[model samples]
Target: MLAKSIDRLPPPRAGGWRYEPKFDGYRALATIQTDSSVQVHSRRGTPLDDAFPELVGALYAYLPAGTVVDGEIVCWAGGRLDFNRLQRRYAQRRHARELAVTQPVHLVVFDVLETAQDGDLRRRPLRERRAVLERLFRRIPARSPLTLAMQTSDPAVAEEWFDTMAVAGVEGLVIKPANSPYVCGARVWLKYKSRQTTDAVVGGVTGSLHRPAALLLGRYGSDTGRLHYAGRTTHLSDAQAAAVAPLLVAAIGGHPWPVRLTVN
Candidate 1:
């Protein structure tokens, strides 16, 4: 399932929502076949087995056959989540074993899709699926590479985690409805990312107005009447692009930086 971005965490209410910290790493699905063979891949269908052999090895050892799971592949370094190391692990697949001893990767699972006891849980409520995932983890060794993602229904606890986890590269909270079933590609869940309010003008954009890739921000010197290039944003998600596309307007003639900003 996917999530739509929101500004803030809503106050607790009846049929309260739950929260999971958003890890800054590769989102992947891990599946163990009936024969105990394992496969892990990203949502885009890119196979990750070669990139993270040790993680796959751990999954094969800990997870039972007929089980499928979804989670992020993260690595830690110097007491914080190290995304660069995570990327290197993906790139140097052949050296995975050597690096696995130095910089081991981890799979922080959040949802259980299929279990040995229950064939499929995608159609089940998230609460039920979570319970199943927790039970499955009970048999895993404490030092196992497979770690369950933290979750809580309490807003206060969520807020506290949102504050503390940011230091560990957790970007934000993924708010989920307890009763919602897993619906692939659906934006039923809401995500609240950590951001500071800043004021800047949309001086330009990378993509077309109807399908903007990212905003090129700028600020004008009041007396000089000059547009100073501020900064480009991270690539916009589909939801963000959709929301901003309609609000964008093409720049007219005499455009600043008209030569096309490119690194030589």
Candidate 2:
């Protein structure tokens, strides 16, 4: 099931809700056949076995046959999860083995879709499925490149994790009803992310005065005190463009961004 994005976390209600960390990585489903062969599928159903050969091999070795799990493939860099590094690893066709050694990946399993004992667990309640997933993790060897993601029912605990774990690469929190089943293609889960606003200098624009495209943003560095490219905003409406035009004075000497470009 996919999660629907929300601006803020909702207050807990009478019924129970399970909160789990939302990872900033590729969403993948790992399937272990009856013969112990492993296959990894992306969220778009693209086969990812070749992209992450080591993870596929490890799943085959560690997980029981006929197991199907949902998780994220994450790579760590500079003491935090690096989505850019993961993207680069995903794009590699050759020299994957060498890159695997230098940039090892880990699969953080969150839910189990199938098991050897029970063919399909999607109909089971989330709490029940989580219990089974926890039991399965206990059987994995200590050195396996797999991790059972943490979950909690307490909103306070979820809030704490959202705040504290951000530095450790946790993106946000995903909340779901405890008794709800895993409805495929359903948006039953709620996502909460922390947002903060800061001041940035407007650098440039795309369209003319009548129809401004976007506002090029920049920030002054603390050490150098020079404007640096931050990012760009979405297209502005006609009224917004008119309001912002008077404030954007042409550069007297030189602009921060010399050439037209997008930062990200």
Candidate 3:
């Protein structure tokens, strides 16, 4: 199921609402075949088995055949979910096993879409589906890559996660109706992300150094104080470009950044 973007979280008075931490990772749907083989793919139908062979191996060992699950593939590092490391894991698919040993990934299973006995559970209400999911997790070891995601109906607990989970790189909260059924590709659930303001350094500009069109922003790493590309600014006004151009100082020796950096 997909979540619709919402400006704010559900009100405290909202009834029958369930809250989950919006994870900072890749959304994946996985299925276990009758022979205990597993197939995993992203929402866009891209194959993910190569990127996370360890996850597939763990799922094959834990889940029963004819089971389908919906979740995110997340990598935890430095006591938090590191999105950069997750990207690296995906990029280094040829050396996935080595990466897994250094920075293992987890499958945060949230919803049980199907089971061995029940062919399909997407039409069932979430409350019942959650019960089935819990039962399945009972036999799986805690250290397994597949883990049940955290869900709570209490608004206070949800608020606590919303306020604090961001430090661990959690995107935000996803709110769903307790009795709502899974609707594929539908924006039935609501998502709210916490907004924060911060400072960034102007590493470079696009278009030209003299007549820049947009700003390339960077932030100094906390440990090394080395500038890392954070993001780019939106299109600049003529006056904004003209005023900022003079501040652009050329890198004396070899620049820290590469000549060609992937924009996205």
lDDT of each: 0.89, 0.87, 0.90
Runs of candidate 1 with Cα error greater than 4 angstroms are 11-14, 196-231, 235-264
TM-score, per-candidate, Cα-based: 0.78, 0.86, 0.79
159: Cα error in model 3, Å:
0.3
The predicted structure with the larger lDDT, 1 or 2, is 1
> Best lDDT goes to which candidate?
3
In candidate 3, the residue pairs with backbone N, CA or C atoms under 3 Å apart (3 or more residues apart, or in different chains) clash, namely none
User: Mind giving the per-residue lDDT tens digits that candidate 2 earns over 1-264?
Assistant: 999989888876656999999999999999999988889999999998888888988898878999999999998899999999999999893767888788888899999999989878999999999999999988887667798989999988998999998897788999999998888899999988766679998877788644577888889999998999898888898788989887777777876677767566
Residues 21-115 of candidate 3: C-alpha lDDT, one tens digit per residue: 99999999999988788999999999999989889998898889999999999999988998899999999999988877788999999999999
Q: Per-residue lDDT for 92-156 in model 1, tens only?
A: 98887888888899999999999889988999999999999999999998798889999999889
RMSD of each: 4.6, 3.2, 5.6
Model 1 per-residue lDDT at 36: 90
Residue 94, model 3, lDDT: 95
Error of 3 at 256 (Å): 17
Model 1: pairs clashing at backbone N, Cα or C within 3 Å: none
- In model 3, how large is the Cα lDDT of residue 61? 89
